[model samples]
Target: MGSPNEMVYIVDDDSTVCDALSSLLRANGKNVRLFSSGAEFLSFERGDVGACLILDLRMPGMDGLEVQKLVSNQASIPVIFVTGQGNVPSTVRAMKGGAVDFLTKPIDEAVLLAAVEHALEKDRIARCEALQQADLLARYHLLTPREREVLPLLVSGLLNKQAAWELGITEYTVQIHRGNIMRKMKADSFARLVKLAGKLKS
Candidate 1:
């Protein structure tokens, strides 16, 4: 189930289509916004929430694929395309562009709801992972200069003596830095520290 704050953006030139989508999504406890054009949808600044886009493939000005390309670079809301013409090329392009699903009209209420659920869930997972990476980065920034210097070498399989030799420091000093790194990074074990190191490097 989605929160009441979770939004569904319906972008279509057809007023009737947008009205129908907004009604369906609102009835299922989702916040809905209707846009008459791709440009109008792009202009709206979305809040930080697990949201998805319902886009019409054909439009007078900027088409669905065009909007998708621009949105991918910015908003990154998951998309479910509803088109009267569900052609092969368009479907392949939308999928490759990271659309959640491509639906054909007359849209089945059940199928659209299922796609919306999947898209929202996917967005939530992505946002959660992003938050974790940000938290890890914050911890990494808390290390002192010497501790930072020692971290990579230790995680790279160097013993304290080896790391000390490489950095022209005493082995005891290296051991101290290692302890500090573990404490600052909140790593329960050396293995966990190594895993954190990998994420930072990547």
Candidate 2:
């Protein structure tokens, strides 16, 4: 079972399979949502909260691979394929297309649960990193042009005097710019400033 904020999306044309999987997941205190087709699943708007998709490989119209293609741009939501007609080529294709796991039907309950847990945890981690990156970029954007100029030099291990010389400004002016950078970035110390700068560069 995952946190209340997490969700598991099941997309399969088979009513029996959808009902069974939904029952199993909800029995274990998980939040489950079901769709009868890949097109319906794709049309649904999902929240940014942690979520993963369990999709069937074969369907009437849009299949698992096609849905994977449509949703590939959404890097945060991972997918796991549950298919009765699994083959070597399809498994390879699913993995290559960035599915988190592939399970043949007559799906093992324990294995399916484990894969769901793993995918949800992965989504949590990716979302956390994305938030941190956005915060770093926002802080970086707050810097004055001169403060921005001073940041890379400080990260590169340049002394205030050397940075001042390079920018053709007084050392005192460089110190002011450095102070402003630190305050605006909310960096507690020199090491923290360096770390934020490294994140921006990466």
List where candidate 2 sits over 4 angstroms from the true fold.
none
Query: Can you write out model 2's per-residue Cα lDDT over 1-202, one digit (the tens) per residue?
Result: 5687899999999999999999998988889999999889888988766888999999998999999988887555889999998999999999999899999999999999999988888888888999999988998999998899999998899999999999999999999999999999999999999998888978
Off by over 4 Å in 1: none
- Listed in order, each prediction's TM-score against the native is 0.96, 0.93
> How many pairs of residues collide in model 2?
0
For each candidate, the alpha-carbon lDDT, in order, equals 0.93, 0.91
Q: Clashing residue pairs in candidate 1, if any?
A: none
Clashes of each: 0, 0
| Native-referenced Cα lDDT, model 1 | 0.93
Candidate that would win on lDDT = 1
Cα error, residue 5 of model 1, in Å, equals 3.0
Which lDDT tens digits does candidate 1 get at residues 132-185?
999999999999988999998998899999999999999999998999899999
